[model samples]
Target: MNAPRTLRAALVYFNDFENCQRFMIDLRWPDGVVRCPTCGSDKVTYLADDKRWKCYAKHPRAKFSLKVGTVLEDSPIGLEKWLPAM
Candidate 1:
């Protein structure tokens, strides 16, 4: 659960999809609140099935994934593979 302390642990820790998601969430929103990257609205709902979030703030870009505003944004690569590499 704690951040990976070494390369081997990071490889294993980031291999799981859920772990990668949780890590990104914590890294981006340390306050434990997921916000809309576009509108910066706290009024967002997680779409678990799609692995994304939807903001209720009447905006064009209402849906986003954890990588939306990060350097990983728009990449086709999965977080499980990306996090460890980073």
Candidate 2:
């Protein structure tokens, strides 16, 4: 077995923006299905370029990020700093 990684090392792991986004996506939707939190619509598309999810439903706000509806929604801090604290 290998020795456990230190806190500093683990933090470095999350420092990568892409990894942080993937981690948050998994944490939020374990089944890997991205849905619209607003209309509860499963018909959503992954906007990779913008790093946000867009709901196909006819709504004023069709686009949203993983941060939507969560406590960290308005926080400037990313999942890189938030997940470690969990």
Candidate 3:
């Protein structure tokens, strides 16, 4: 009987929210143009204390997380767990 091949994957996951935030920031706004994800407004602000993005356009969804509008939406799991799963 041949045993099933169980592939072991070693994922280097980062638990630091800042690291994850920086990574997403780099991917979404590679040119340093941090626009509002909701309204596409370039006048967006970064709340380092809250670790989120705020849009100055006065929209319903002004404040957003790095996970907003992404595959991580509506997921309660933290980035540490999510990265490993990916």
Candidate 1 lowest-lDDT run of ten: 1-10
Clashes of 2: 0
Q: Rank the candidates by TM-score, best first.
A: 1, 2, 3
Q: After superposing candidate 3, which stretches have Cα over 4 Å from the reference? A: 1-13
Candidate 1 global CA lDDT score: 0.90
9-63 per-residue lDDT for model 3 (tens digits): 2134246565566666776788858788888888888898887889989879899
Model 3: colliding residue pairs: none
- Where is model 2 more than 4 Å wrong at Cα? 1-6
What lDDT tens digits, residue by residue, belong to model 1 across residues 54-76?
99999787999999988899789
Off by over 4 Å in 1: none
Which is the winner by TM-score between candidate 2 and candidate 3? 2
Candidate 3: residue 71 Cα off by (Å)? 1.1
Tell me the whole-model lDDT of each prediction, alpha carbons only.
0.90, 0.79, 0.70
Per-residue lDDT for 18 in model 3? 58
Worst 10-residue lDDT window, candidate 3: 1-10
Q: Which candidate would rank higher by lDDT, 1 or 2?
A: 1
Best by TM-score: 1
TM-score of each: 0.91, 0.78, 0.74
